[model samples]
Structure formats: structure tokens, C-alpha cells
Target: MAQKTVLFKHLEQPEIHRLDVYRDAGGYGALRTAVNDLAPAEVTQMVKDSGLRGRGGAGFPTGMKWSFLPKEYDTSYLVCNADESEPGAFKDRELMERNPHQLIEGCLLAAYAIRARHAFIYVRGEYLAIKELLDAAIEQARQAGLVGERIFGKDWGCEVSVYRGAGAYICGEESAMLDSLEGFRGFPRLRPPFPAVRGLYGKPTVVNNVETLANVPHIVANGAEWFKSTGTEKSPGTKICSISGPVNRPGNYELEMGTPFRYLLEDCAGGMAGGKSLKAYIPGGASAPMLPGDCQDVGIDFESYPAAGSTMGSASFILFPEDCCIVFAQLRISEFFSHESCGKCTPCREGSRWLRQMVERIEEGGGREEDLPILLDVTDNMVGKCFCALGDFATSNIVASIRHFRHEYEQHIRERRCPFRPHPAAEPLLQIAGVA
Candidate 1:
């Protein structure tokens, strides 16, 4: 079956980012219907029925997250996570840049459902262009009475604001984001006081991904059943996948949840670059466990990925060509986590650094046979002991690479060099290690 485009339907239109262009394409009609006709509870129920899950790393059900908010909070907030800092993830950037109004409408609908008077989009600092576009869109909506004051002349009103983060990957986590939004250093808070309970100034808050919230207007404009009709029963609605790394065509492509990975790589991404054969691919973002290239038959959905020993995290498909070294790839990933760790927990802050060192040693041909076991041991210690998922994310690529390509690490030790490709610096590193 051909991939269906939901969020990107009108994305190709050059001026679709403008307010008038968006309105002509039937924008804000859903917000009008939601505000004028449907009750707040009804909107929540509709989203629940749609079976929409978070497009963020954790595939938690979106409606379920909203339902966790207290029914009698004095004030509540809807936070849109626009931090597209995850390596190989850029779908949210495209959505916010091209269809800022769509996201605003989605935020409006979500705010209405949760009865939140104020909504904040915590966009990463790097997305300055997107922030400018969203600022213009929000101002446009405010002037037209679509946002702020009596929206569309209805009783309910919502004030949408944009907050910029200091480019911390940990801020992508909900509690950490709340801490950042509250003018504190970005660090993950302990659970039991989840964001739904106490978030954004100790008031109940609902934090959702940009793509997850972008589906709200469609669900409101059409119906729950309409939204559910597209994707699988468990993972409904279209997902915008950000394809990157060594592909002939690297860009964002929106498709139904159950579409095969083969279609995405071959038809959508135009296959691998330089006629290279497949080696390995990160099924989701860099956080997700990497899968062998032959797993292309695996369906691109939440349930399907885990069954195949991977995850559909953020749907950021990072394809690695055959020439790419897995150990070097993991070393780079480890370096990212090490640099991004908030130092909130000892295991993550220290373990991430150690993991990077281990991978670097292995890549530099200084690894001993015991280094593989040591890497696995360090990953095990870091997985559940950290404050947030960052530690676990740091482990994913290392654990998955070691599991699937243990021989790659072993060959590096036995041959005292990377067998696949010559590392010019490997000789110098081995000389420093007093090997060979």
C-alpha cells in the first residue's frame, strides 16, 4: 500500500505557512468546532478513541497522558515538546517550520481538551527560525481572535507562548523540560510527581511532542474513527519519519504506522547512497536500538519494533551504509550522550563518559577481549539506576551493537585493527597502547 500523507498534505504549498493560506485550506475550523460544539470531556474521549500515541521516544498513549491531569486544578498547562535535539530526528522541525498554524491549532485543541488556559511550546534554542515562524503565527492567530481572548467568539480562551531551551537533550524528558520551563537548570525530576500531577510551576501540565499534538486538529475536524482508520489499531494515525544518514534522499516522510521499512528505505528514501549494500540501521532515533539491515520486513510501528528487538522511538530512521563502522558509530553516539548528560545522576553522568571511552578505545584498536564484557557490564549498571531515560539511551546503541556485532568488536581485538576499514590513526593509538 502507498504511504498516506496527513500532516504533510499541504506542506508542499510555498505559502502554506502563512495564516491566510492555512485558513483557506480549512485550518482553525476544527478549533471552531471544538470550542463551539464539543465539550472539553468529549474532546478528550475523542482523542482516547483515536488511539493516538506519543511520537516522542516513549510511545505512551496521548489521551491517557491527558487523562492523568487532575480534574480540579486551579491552573493547568499544555506543554508542546519542540526540542528536536535527538540526533537523526528532525520531523518536529519540519512540522513547526512549514505548518506552524497546524501545531498552534493542535495546541489550542489540546489546551481546550485539558481545560488549560495557557500552553507553552518548549522549542530548542537551535530552532530560532521555527520560533520566529511560530511567533508570527501565534500573533496572527491572536489578532484574528483565534487565540487569546474569546477564541472564535467562543467562551473558552487559550494563550499560547513559546519558550526556548538552552539545547539540553535531557530537557526532552518531560520532568526535565518542566524544570527548564520553570527557570531552573534542566534536570530530570523523580517520578510519582509526574508532569500530569505537578508540572510547570507545580500546576498540572500535559507535555506532548510536536508531531503528536499536530494530529489533534485532524482528530477534532474529522472524527476519532477517521483518525483510527489510517494506522494499525494499536498505533493509529500517520507518523512523520525523519530519514537521515547515508541515503540517496534524506528527508522527512509521513506514512501510515504499519508501512514496511523496506518501502521507506527503497521508495521513500531512494535507497542507500553510492549503491552500497545495507549494513545496519537505527529503526528509530539514535536512542533506539540499532537493527540489522535485513530486518526491513519489520513494520514501522510501536508494537512491531519491540517484537523485533528494537523500538519506534521518534520514528527517526538513521540508515548506516555498509562502509560505516559500527564501533565508530557507537563511539560517536556515546560521545553525544556523555556531553548531553545533565549530571543529575552518578550512573548516567559517569557511565556515559566511561562508555564513550570504551567505545573509543575499541574503535582505536586498543580494545582487549574483556572490553566487550566490561562495556556490557557498564551498560547494565546504567540502565535502571539513572534519573531519566538518557542513561538508558546511552546504553541502547552500545548494547545493540555488541549483541548483534560482537564479532566486529572481537575482530578489532584479534586483528588489532578494524578489519572493515583502515583507521589511519589506529596505528598511532596502538603504538601509544604499546600493542604491535
Candidate 2:
């Protein structure tokens, strides 16, 4: 967060997020260069050399994902997973809303690289303004002949359309986004056909997160070596991290990969609010396991997080100051996953309801001491038993809190009340059976 490096480079520019300013800064030149000069295969190889991975929750390599598409497929597509519904994660929304043309240019380059004829920008329904912004940008690109038929006046042409999601968290999942974009109920499909081989209308598709695609224009424009110079050897370039919760400066801060977590919190975020001591931090979005306050010194990158027993998901760093209860935080997180369960499998659908109910009972002063083991049991049953990641997504919060702060849950049960009351809005909610 210190110094606000990569992803935020344009945020401070006067109208820098606008297309005109972006072009002046050498924006869509990447697309023109790629389409005009480089072969699609060569472009993909450049991305591979740059070591760009998915900025989405999953940290899959971008070029590797694109390579998964079989060569024979005629109509491949790219769906920008702009459905930034992960709780405490809003980086993608910022990218699409502010630097939309960058994403469009990246999309065009990616479509050309993957030989995708048509692409779709699946914007989150809640971001109607961003949806409008991107739509206008796409139109502008079309008018300028940067998109649509005969892009740059060559035989190869690709067009893109913006598809609005109906505000479902499950749609953020790549396969589910395909289902939703195709006008289905947004349930996750089984993997194996994976989406590279079978996706969006039953053809090959390359789904990249908005931030991931945003980097493509930069990568294509500046060469792979230039992109490689910014961050760690394995994880190059900067990450847009959003710091909230009791921070003096609670906003998105872009920093080079592998930056220390301490620097991100204490330096970039201007330290905690009111000079309070840090308690715990959710390194990734809510779905990732929480990290104890002792682990705050770990580096913020793809490699360091798993070693620290967390993920660098979407580079979201939600800080919790001291005096905040982990039980309260865990309950809030559990409720989100439980509510967002796509109901594709019983383990998540039923297990999330039970977890929420058990946590609520403990929080509300009515739970038994024996319920602690039962909560673990519920999560244990659901962890790998569900259809999609949604089930594991629901269980991670419970397991993480219990693993790190079982004593906190016991304290709530023994005291029969929450210990800290910072905000009236923080009033704990009791679980109603069958509500989840």
C-alpha cells in the first residue's frame, strides 16, 4: 500500500481514468501492436514469459489458462470475470469503473491471442454505473475501429459485448458466470471439460479476471521483460490491495508483489485508525482462511500466503484492529458464504445453514459447550464433499476461526455475550433455523 504503485498508477491522474488520457499515456497501443505485428501464439508466449497469473481468487497462470483451449475450436470467447462479489473485495470494480479502456484493450489482445472471435465483459449487476462506463468504452473502441469488425483493418477481427450479471455471488465463479451469461440459474458446473474446452455456448472460452486482463495491455505494450522487472521472480507486477476496517486511510493501494504485509498495513494504509494496535487480518477475501495478528509480518504475494496458511486472493487485505472479537468477525463472514451458497450441493446448502445456526446460538448466549465439536464436525463433513468451491468456501471461515481462536468462541459461550461493542451496527444476529 505504501506509495500506491502499479494498479493505481492512473487513479491520481486528472481524468487519467478516462479514455483520452489513457490513450495519451500509451494505452491501446498494445492491442494495435499485437494485432498488427505479433502472431497470436507469440503473444501467448510473451504472457507466459511475463509470468502473469490470474488476479482472480484462484492464482492460475493466465497464459497457461489460455493455452488450455484446443486449437481446433473455431469460436472461442473470453469472459472478464468482473463479478467482484467476494465480501471485502472491490478491486475489480475499481479497475472496470476507472480504467475500463485498459481492460477493453487487454480483452482485445487476449481475444486475438486466443483466437477468440467474440468476447463478453460480464460486469456485476450491482455495478450498474461501471456497466454503463464499460459499455460506453466498448462503443468508443468500436467507433475508433479498435474493436468490432476488421480491427486495425486486418483479416482477423474480434467483437466484444457487455453482459450484466443479476447480482449473484456464485456468478463470480468462472463456470457459473458462463451459465449466467447464457441465461441460466448461475449454478456451478462440474470441471473436466473445464471452461477452456467447453464453455459459454458450449465452445472454448478463456475466462480472466478484470485485473488479470488489465495487465495484458501493459504486458503486450512493454514486452515481457518489462513486466517481469516489477515484482518478485515468481509473481511479477503490482497488486491492487484494498485495506478497510479501522485503517486511517481505507482505500485501494497498489503495490509491487511480495511487498511485506507490515509495510502494506503500517505504511501504505497509514497505520490503523486512531493509532490502535492490530488484532487480525484477512489477507485475502473472506473465503480465505484468516491469519493471526502474529502472522502480519508475512509478505503479500502468491508464494508467501499459502506458507502463512492463507491466500493472496484478489490482493484484498481487510485489517481488524485490537478489541475486535474474532467470533463476531467469523460469524459475519460465515453468514455471507452461507447466504451466497449456490445450493448446487447438499454439503454446502445444508452445512452452511447448520454452521450459521450453531455460531448464532453461541453468540446469542444459548449454545451448549458440546456445540463446539459439532461445529467442527459440520465443517469436516462439508469440506471436500460438495460439488463446487462454494462448499469449501463456506467451511473455511469456521475452520480458520476455530483453529486460531477457539478460546474466543468459548468466551462468547461462557460470558453469554459479545465482549466488544464498537458500533451499534455491529449488533450480533441470532441464527434462525432454515433461514440459511
Candidate 3:
């Protein structure tokens, strides 16, 4: 574990969230350097040179995203996506709650680099506590002249605002988040006129995830080469892997990119819980296809998992025990996507419903042999057919479940019940003495 701590090192220090404590610890020095010495282009180029990618699942290049703004734009915005709504992903929330100024300073550095005066942190409404923590951090920064006007007594200044959204899973999508921030219903907007070109009040905007922005200050303070020295060439710096499910030490572990999943499972998480052997695991969140547990040697980076036919999205690993029912597990996922569908696209709105119904029926022992192909066909139609990835996300579980655990599904149908999971106890029966 040669991974040097970029985000987690100082988290335990008391009052680390305070602007004063953070500044004394040499925080915001990157923002100061950018404001005092570096030009906007230089800062942007530095991030570009560092090879920072979005940590919010997509793995898109951060520098290129900032560079997308037109050369001359009067108005632009920088949105820090703090809506950590994905199940098994709580990295952003933890970052903001513990070391808030780091995220704030990162946002300001990015705002300066992009030449955007206004930055907004669109946090999930459920994270009211985190929102307030950020709010206080912003005010503290403002009072100290780090935000508001003339940051660091320089001509350039960036103001950061914390905006909360109704808890919509769809809002985690950048476009939908834009719509929600703009006071519209949280629905995903169509692309082609991508947010970088025309976004947030019809102006150029750059939306970076909480963890992505939090990395900015570190990259600025430490040279790109220094940052690059930690992780793989493509994925530089450590990644906070949010480990969940039945692991003995189920929590967040910051590991260098390219660290094998086996290390995380055995060394960090202390292996599976209750002495249960691994059955299957979601390499990413629910949106990623589940990989059989035997693939533990797969590296936790942008490339490795996909090479193994699964995504390393957000690195939200959810493991399953051998005794777990694959059919029932997928049923819950289907139900969630069905309920959270934004209803913006027909394939997603309708396809998700159909998948959930069929999966529910199959899990409940009402499925026919023919239902499997029908389910696959439904997911086939749903994948990449929706306005957003939500539609495509809904398909990963079912498709991967059958691909890897088809035997389990077959058992469910053959036995007319979930073999791994115990069924409800039979109703108690009593007979009257006279009747007997």
C-alpha cells in the first residue's frame, strides 16, 4: 500500500473542517498559488497534465472537461456534484463532512481555472448535515476573503454556493442535476448541446464530482508528476473504494488505483463475513455488472474490471455470500430502478417496469421457463434506449445475473422457489377437541 494519502491523511485532526485549522495546515495554498502566480490557462493545464478523471463513475478526464468551455465566455459555472445518492457510494459525503474546506478550495481552484466566478455545490437534500457543513465552510472562506471578491487580494475571485436538491437518484446525472439546479424538475436533459457548451442558465458549465474536485487542490499543491507517481499512468492518485455488503470490515478504504480487489477483500475488508465463501460481487455500484467472486485478482482501476467484463464504476463493491439467492438479489435491484426511473424515456419508464414485474414473479416462484429469454429481450431493448444511462443501468444486473448465475435462475424455476433462501414458514394449524 504505497498509496500516499491525498484526501484521508488529515481527516482525524480535530477542527480540520474549520477554515483556520485548514489554512494553518497549508490548505488553500493551491488556490493562493493560482490566484497570485498562475494564470487561468496554467491552472487548467496543470490539472490536464495531472490526468485527473471524474470519480463519479464515468471516469472522464477532468482537465479536458474544464478545457471544453469556449475561449471567450462572459458567463460560466462550476458545479461540484455532491449528490452521493448511489447505493454503496458514500465517498463524497464523507469527504464533505470531514474535510469540507478541501472540497471548497478545490472548487475555487477549478472555478478560477475555468474563469468562472460562480461555483455551486449541488448536494443531495438527504445530506442536510453535509450541506450545512459546507455552508459554514463557504461562509468562513468568504469572511477570510478566500471566496466572494478579489480572492487572495487578486483580481480573480470565485464565489461558491451550496445548493440542495430533492433526493432524486436521477439528479446524480450531470444534465439532470443542471435541470434541478435551474429550478426545473430533476429530469435528464438531452445531449448534443452538452453541458460544457450550453449549461446552467444557458451558459458554459463544468460539472465535477465531489471527489474529483477534492483532488484539485492536491494536484495543484503537489506537481502533476508527484500526483502521477501514486496510481497508474492513466489513473493517477489514490481512489476511495467504498466497500459494502457482507465484508468483515465493510467501509471505505482509500487504495492506490490498480490495487487488486483481492487485497481489498482479504487485507482491508478482512474477507467475507460469517465465514461465508464469496458467491458474486458488484465491482462498482448496482449499475455495474456483477462479477463472479473468483475474479478477485481483477485490479481496481478504470481499465482492469472492464477487461474482466465488468465496470469499476465509483468502485462501490457490494459482495454476496454463496448462500445468497441471485434471483432475489436482482429482484431488489429491478424494483429500485423501476421506482427511481425519471419517466423521461419510454424504454426506461416502461422497460424497467416490465423487468421488475418479471423478476419479482420469478423470485416469488411464479416464473415459467420461457420467462428468462423474455427478460433478456426486455433488458436488450432497454439498454442504451433511454434518454439517460438510468435505462442502461437497469439492465446490467439482470443481464449479468443470468450470464454468471443462470444456474441459480434455472434452479429457482425448476424448484418453483428460491433454493438458497428459506421460504416463509407454513401457517400453523390447530384442530378443536370436538372436531378431533
Candidate 4:
């Protein structure tokens, strides 16, 4: 069943990004209520009660993250992870483009809860237009006293700024994002002092995704019970799923958490395009293990995915059609991870590159029978040994492909060619790689 839109309720409104249109639709009302009536701890408790989790890949509890700040810190910072560079993740981009104020309001409320004096949004350089939109929104909010000194005439004050990243996928990680924001190269930091303990110039910090923060205003405006009433208890509220790859209607669809995977593909996304049958799908972008087509019975939420031997990483679904070549797909995904590896850790830096080479050789019809075990071995080595999740992401698709479709790899080795034809768009690349 299609649940009513919460975060995307006002998405269709023209000029919704503008403060006037947004305010008319109850934007910033939550921040005002939070500031005027509720204490910072009270607001944090409300979010915890709402069961709101981070929409970022990790699915960490948002309120719990806020609560991690030291009670007596001199300075605390809130950083918004706006780097939507995951291969198929565009939900954050759309949310920021359509409902800028909602995110600003979320940031303000979050900062208030953490007692953060300043907040920075680390946006990817590729999202130039989104930066412009958010910058304008921030300026407008400052002028209207929705941001900056004594917001809503309350004694509390918080400033929000937009910092554009240099287009590194690793920056999406909280520690790397802080590094980039601090004018350093994007690289994951050691975890002895997590961001909650020490971040953004040695101050306690809270990092949240764009979509995750965007949900804050709604949770505050409506009561926590109302917010929790929709999705499952553990994964309450609607999720903005970005569906792509061979779907008839590939775009962002806001559905309640725990909605079945079948509902997303068939009902919301209009099923596979061009009369194609589903083969497999990445339940949550390229970093998540792909689920077989028959796993449609699985629910699209945090708890459900892990139970189904997959994950709900960013809720970016990339579907594979019947004619799609799993080996070729894995090769492409491996290449992406390889190119994006920050080289900060030997496991991710070297393992991802080696994985890409192995996948490329197999995809180009140079596979040896020993390659499969080597691939799995490489993936296992990189899984828990990397400095950050990027290394784990590099192995997700490759490992899942081997688990579900090992025969595909065997066929490539046996026949000395890709059993499936390359897509027309990939034909040039395959030819260039000497894959006849």
C-alpha cells in the first residue's frame, strides 16, 4: 500500500524551495516550536522517541548520535553530509533541491539539541546547483531570523554554512567529510575518538545525511507517535528510495519503511522497463549486496534487509534486468570503487584496485578457474580490515554476485566469453577493452 508522503508532501509545490512557499506549508514551524517550547534535551528525546535513524548508509540512530556530545563541551559542531556520490543515490539531491528549508530547519533543530554553535553542510562539488539553492535558502533564513543570532527571538543562536567538497566519494564518510570541511584531503580517521567524541577541530560533533536531517522538521511538527505510526517500530517513517536501472519509472519514491521490495519495483516504479524481467537488484545502491529477483518478498527497511542477507544502504535501488550480465555489472561497480578509493588504507586502496583488475580480466574473457576463489579471498580480506566503509562497499556487489550467480562466472570461464551481450552503451568500452 502507498503511504502518504511526509518529507515529500510539499515537493510538488512550485517555488517550494523558496521560504515564502515553504513557510506557508508549515516549514520552519518545527524549529520555532522546538526553540520556543521544548528544551534541547526535550527535542533530542522527541527524536529518539520517533525512532528516527540516519538515512545515510550506516542507519545509526539519529537522536543517539546527538546525545553523544559531551555535556560540558566548550564547542560542538553539526556537519550535514550532503555528498550524494553513491553510484545510484540521488534522493538527497532531490530533497535538497525541492525542500531546502526543511533541511535547514532540521539542521537548526539538531544544532539546538547538541548545543552546537555552528553547523556546516559538506556538499559535493558536482551538486553546484544544490549548493546555490541551499546557500540562498540559508541567506533567506538568516534574514528572516530563522537562522543566526537569537533565532525566533530565543536566546539560543546557531549559524549554518555551506562548504562544497572536492568531489571525493570517501568524503561521504563522517570523518572524511570533516577532514574535507577543514580544508584537508578527504580520508577516513581512526575511530578511537569517533566524531561524537572529537570532530571538526577537536570538538564534539554530530554528522547527519541530507535526507536524514530533512526528516527532522516533520518529526518535530507532528508528534513522535504520529511519526512512528507509519513504518515498522524499528524503522519508522517514510524513506525516500531512489530507484534506477531498467525500471519503467526510475526516480525517487517516498514509501513507508517496511514496504515490500515488490511494491517498490512493481507498483511504485512501474516494474522493469522494455518488457524486461528482473534478474537481481542492489537493494541499497552499489555498496549493498544485490538481492536475487525472487527476494521481492523482502521488506525495504533497515531491519528487513539484514534479515534477508542484504542491507538498506542509502535506499538507492539499482535493478538488474534479465539480460543484464552480472559479471559485467560487478566489473563496472568494482571499477568505480577502485577509482574512488582514497588510498588512505592499504586494504581499500590496493584491494579495490586488485578487485577491479580481477573483475575486468574476467569480464573481458580472460578468466581463469582459480579467479573465483581469489576474488572471494580478496573481498574477504578487504571486508573488515579497511579504515572505513568504502572498503566494505567495494566488496559488497562482488561478493553478492558470486554468492547468487557463481554459474555466471563459471560460464564466462568455460566459454571464454561473456554469455550475455553487452548493453549498447557499454559496447564501445567492451570493444576498447578487447572483449570480442
Best by TM-score: 4
lDDT by residue (84-164, candidate 1, tens digit) is: 778878899989888899999999999999999999999998988888889999999999999897887777899999998
Candidate 4 regions with alpha-carbon error over 4 angstroms:
425-436
Tens-place lDDT per residue, model 2, 150-205, is 98899888888989999888999999999999998999998888999999899999
Q: If scored against the real structure, what TM-score would every candidate get? A: 0.96, 0.95, 0.95, 0.96
> How much RMSD separates candidate 2 from the native structure?
3.1
For every candidate structure, what is the RMSD over all alpha carbons to the true structure, in angstroms?
A: 4.4, 3.1, 6.4, 2.8
- Order of models, best lDDT first: 4, 1, 3, 2
TM-score winner, 1 or 2: 1
TM-score of 3: 0.95
- Give the per-residue Cα lDDT of candidate 1 at 316: 85
Across 109-175, the per-residue lDDT of candidate 3 in tens digits comes to 9999989999999999899999888898899889999899888788888889999999888999999
Query: In candidate 3, how many clashes are counted?
Result: 0
